[model samples]
Target: MTAALTVSIVVPILNEADNLPKLFEHLHQLTAKPQQIIIVDGGSIDGSFTLAQSLMTEMITIQQSAIDWQVLASSAGRALQMNRGAALASGDVLLFLHADTKLPNQAMTEIALAITQAKWGRFDVHLDSNKLLLKLVGSMINLRSRLSGIATGDQAIFVRRRIFEQLGGYPNQALMEDVEISKRLKAIGKPACLTSKVITSARRWQQHGTWHTILLMWRLRFDYWRGVSPDSLKRHYYNT
Candidate 1:
């Protein structure tokens, strides 16, 4: 078997105290561990930074592994926080993960193989919900991403460190940073589109009503494509 790539997982967070424990547990259970895990907090007031620091300390002490775990504070924006984490990474590949998502078993091994074939890639995403419609939603999302070569952040996007830095990392926008970066990367080549799925929270759909959330996302993407500024879209997204 080929040696796995050195992967660094960068997770950007804001008020994710409730989800941090489970995310850490998932990391501990990975079939092939990452070289490091960086958690960048966006000035969360919910004690998220402290919790992340505590978890990192405990994980390091218990595992006694060489994995570098860092908890950093950044301005309150997903794009900015992710960029900060990426800047500190020291691995061959960087995987931007969401706190509410859980990678499947063998994710690191799968990514290692995928990276050999493409400069960047993303895993298929499965929404964690029992609703039949939500299951269909997840399937459609995966199919759409596969056909379009555009990845959403929830899919666990991974890329070669060199290429990522060359592209100047994610655009410092309030929204659609994933889509923007995917377009830039696709200009070089299509994404690997791995079959392994990352399970992500369905909280948005649950909170907003599945159909409503789906329609909102489609509308947002259409508006974004039509050249609507991310600042304008952000207000609509958060219903501000």
Candidate 2:
């Protein structure tokens, strides 16, 4: 256990074995130190837990038997998992990271730096797809981050833990939790955007067809804005 900062990095996963090592290494590249790295595993069958154990022995300072790992049955949706992660986090600032996203080396310094200046912030998103349209979409996403302060899960939002608890945390939904919580965060205060962006896999779009996925997401957003339940939205979506 290193000196704890005001920030904690929280991540949730389910059968993401292939990507976990990269995520942990990228977490090393990330900004904050042992701000409590909370890993919420939702019943992985492919030995992802075993890998998390093996990897923890390297970067983390926790005793082998006392690593900050929590395993849940796959019943808790993404929203629930995020909330669980937040509860276990000990930092004043809570960071929500996706399993497939990679952060830059200077992330923690930037995070602490931003905490002094703002209450909340999110990294800009860079998708790992080679498609020209995806590049365009990434530009639009950056623009959205700038204009609306609405960064998706891949972008990773960090906020003071007290503020998160005061605001009642994320809405438990299968989808749209990021958007909903971000709306609340932006309502309380403007969030800072870091130049150190997080890169995400574009496997979902590639598998589902970029245009189709884009259209579906657009529809989901529209429905969410109109107060559709997240569970219903996720029921309609074929996830990543």
Candidate 1 residue-wise lDDT at 109: 88
Window of ten residues with lowest summed lDDT in model 2: 65-74
- What lDDT tens digits, residue by residue, belong to model 1 across residues 1-240? 134469999999999999999999899888788898999999999999999999999899988966788999999999999999999999899999999999987988888888888999999988998889999999999999999999999999999999999999999999999999999999999999998889999999999899999999999999999999999999999992
Off by over 4 Å in 2: 1-4, 29-34, 61-75
Off by over 4 Å in 1: 1-4
Give me the displacement of residue 116 in model 2, in angstroms.
1.8
Clashing pairs in 1: none
Per-model TM-score on C-alpha atoms: 0.98, 0.88
Cand. 1 TM to true fold:
0.98
The superposed Cα distance between candidate 2 and the true structure at residue 161, in angstroms, equals: 0.7
